[model samples]
Target: MPHPASAAPTSRFPAWLLICGSLMAIAPLSIDMYLPSFPTLAGDLGVDIGQVQLTLGAFLVGLALGQAFYGPFSDRFGRKPPLYVGLCLYVLAAMGCALARNVESLMLWRFLQALGGCAGMVMARAVIRDRLEAHESARAFSSLMLVMGVAPILAPIIGGAVLTVSGWRAIFWVLSGAGLLILLLVHLRMEESLDRRHAAPLRLGTVARSYAELLRDREFLGYSLSAGFGSAGMFAYISGSPFVLIELHGIAPSHYGFVFGANALGLITMSQLNARLVRGRSLDQVLGATLLAALAAGMVLAVAALAGMAVLPVLLGGFFVFIGALGCVSPNASALALAHQGHRAGTASALMGTLQFSLGTLGGAAVSVWRDGSALPLGVVMAACGAGAVLMRHYGRSGARARPGAR
Candidate 1:
């Protein structure tokens, strides 16, 4: 195992950390970059806006399912092998997306793209767990949020520029190139982090039983659900924002990237702050506080929408607050969820990703199905997710307190 001191808070940020963050960034890059082109994509494909949104949902589904397999594969073989396979597949699928002719084909390619890209997400978490304890892992995750946050801030701007210059097809070409570049980086720089002696078997029944046991773990469930619902709220924003800003509020597609970047900036700032906050307080304490703040933001958003006050400033403010809270919530919740699962870190990480993306898929689908040319549905769904996260956190704390020798 690598020295734990290498991940120490005072140590300089490392190259391997950057590689892990880049790996985990595939999702945000794939999701956010195409957002600015939604209207154009709909027009070019000769489909309605909703059909274009289906591609996003399909990608989320792929992320949810793909992580499950990647986790075990990483554990059974080694981290680098699954990453090599996944990135290769990602490059090919991205090329497929670039060449897609219709909405149906686009959705199919996006799903395949996600299947290939999510290996990074699963393995990055497992790798971090393999190298650090709970507290250090939280700090590392916060650092990762800093890195991943840049994707949302830049992807749309890059996408909008590509859309303006070449066309929507060019966006997928950019993604393909990115996947290829990352694949090369992984091959050259990423050392295998999994200790071979501790590798879990890739047996079907064993994997199922492992996942079932994790589900039965109250602390794990709490952190997972809290993180999942918090993420679901963000996915709700991602699904709803393009229409709410560009179509309803008359923000030009070309200029939409700036508005999206502002929200992402907020998220990034809060995540960095969370890194400091955890130094003074426990992860649970910080997570609980942030979850409450998220709940408040969501309720405010819902109230504003219901009051027919879905103006630009109101919506943006609500989204900034709600999404920003996730920066703190995610790192803390993820660290807590996998804190005790070092023996099966890959499986734990995969299950957590699966739940998070599954909830996110539902959140995106809800926004699509409940699209009434208004922001009410988005507000309600986000608010509901926020409430659920808070409740789950409370339940988890209660359960922890009830146990005789709980962590």
Candidate 2:
């Protein structure tokens, strides 16, 4: 079938992109916004920084698992219902997080909060797929990165301010309020984009088979893995940056947001550049170039750390390049992955998200486990994951050529 018309007019920033972007922003806001509070959380909960990092891991785990459920549910029930359910759960769970009095309870609440927040992540992509062709989807996803990028740039800064004035717990209260606002916007402005004719069944065996089929598709695996590992590098940074910057480097907790936001600004800039580049170039071309850039940056970062040259300037430079490259990498990879999977967009999106966050969880966990009061662990993880992304893309292309009939 011919691809549906573009989701919204391309001439100007549309309302639909805004809404979808906000939905996608949920994860970033939830993850980045509270990062400045790691030290405070550790002190308040009577735990060390590593334990506080575990809470982040818990959230990533929830995000990964929750997407699996929401993907199928959105596919079967139409997008809006699962979003309603998820957002409500997110609101409640945010409150739970705010009220948690111990590290264990905070971890559990963070997990639940992620479970609720991830609906927006999966469904936003599916909704975009529901309305646009692959190339248009590429541009749209880039636009989304532009929209969603604001959250990370602002979240940490806002979070730090809240932490200073109201305390660490108040950060979650802010999150709770953000969740409510998004929920209201969804109810008032968003429309269900899933066409019933394309809806999949909610059967157990069918879902398993669908996911298995996705796993076996080499092209899908390539795009998914490349995006997953590239993104995993970012998660590694997020997991380790608090301790590395504040404790080891002697940066103030409040100033950490500026550093984080600077990298995020790089991300936003590169994503928009990708958007313009794709208008003339193939998605694969842009993806290939960015993946190489990421690998190079990752290596530079790893080398700097190993050489004991991981000063603030060196670390920020490496991170900006690596993370900025992801601006081009993720949107292109995602558009390519979902290019041929429109019939089951929700399922495809879910599987892609699962891979991304599952690797992300591992990245975060690896940092926490390797916490040695040095930046070496974070650097190594970023470099390794970036290499993984490049290899996956290369093999994915080779496999696609070898099995011309795979899709």
Candidate 3:
């Protein structure tokens, strides 16, 4: 195995793949690992499900705000120190989460936890940019997704077992330990990908200007939104699936993890294959294929739902294919969008990820509101987001033409 550090920068990759994967996995690990524990939390904290769910929104808000700072700080200072500080904070906040006596306290701690976690999550992409060229970045990102993908596949099972054996608090103990381990790996072995070439005193003003520029630029927004909405499509499925399956189709809550893992498997499978698909095609061409495929798959699901095809296997199987296309669409579209934002990659990545997650949270919320023990609402939501992705792509090319500098 090539070392993630000290690997020669050839077109061929070395072991930095592990670093990329580990970094990207941080948030998914945090989220997925805690999901199965939500019920326990609600019961223990003497709160309703909605109260417990707010913890998710709290964490998401912190992630967005913290990402805004992390990218600029990393650009200004260096990659390693910010992460070290952030991870330390993460451990503390996670411990706080474990100890909280009420819903309000848990929400506050979860927010802090996300703030700290965003350091690793955002910078992972920046570090990837630091080490690789554009095409290489896309490939490396896909490889990283492969690493992060394991969280959804395994977190629930582990959380379930922990819940059965110990209690919800045990979940935080696991997280705290994981954070400590990551902290060690990073300090002992992870080298600073932020090089001397970065402009001195990477000022907040400069970062602000970068965000300003990205906002004014339509191509960046369009491509970014395509990826963002594609993510929202998956979120729609996630929020609606449990109800649609459990209440409507009678799947057990205990088996929800397996159902969830099946979808993630589709995502992982597609992401792993993305590099091969793009080998000879232009990035846009590959992205177009993925988007069209998503649109097509979603149309199938919509039809199935409208036609009273209420079978659980078919509903999930269709979404399995749909989310798989999304896995391909999201990374490739994001890679293409950020291709030229070298000086402001952190800001760009933060903006993209923030909007992606925000849209995700919104889509999930929509499912909860519109839910009625049927698959139609979820199918409609997925189809709507899929269509939005297509429109975003349509606008992205035009925007690219208008803004000559958008890379």
List RMSD in Å for every model shown.
1.5, 1.9, 3.3
Residue-level lDDT tens digits of model 2 in 322-403: 9999999999999988888888899999999999999999999999999777899999999999999999998667656666
- lDDT per model, in order? 0.91, 0.91, 0.76
Tens digits of lDDT, candidate 3, 119-219: 88777877776666667667777777778889888876777777778898888889888889888888777777766565446666766778888877777
Off by over 4 Å in 2: 1-10, 402-407
For model 3 the TM-score comes to: 0.90
TM-score of each: 0.97, 0.97, 0.90
Candidate 1: list runs displaced more than 4 Å.
1-10, 402-404
C-alpha-based local distance difference test score of model 2: 0.91
How many times do residue backbones clash in model 2?
0
Give the Å shift of residue 74 in candidate 1. Answer: 1.1
Report the C-alpha lDDT of model 1 over 1-407, residue by residue, as the tens digit. 43342356355367778888999899999999999999999999999999999999999999999999988888889788999989999999999999999999999999999999999999999988888888889999999989989999999999999999999999999999999999999999888888888879999999999999998888888889889999899999999999999999999998999988988899899989998999989999999999999999999889999999988898989999998999999999999989888888899999999999999999999998898889999999999999999998887676566656765
lDDT score for residue 335 of model 3: 76
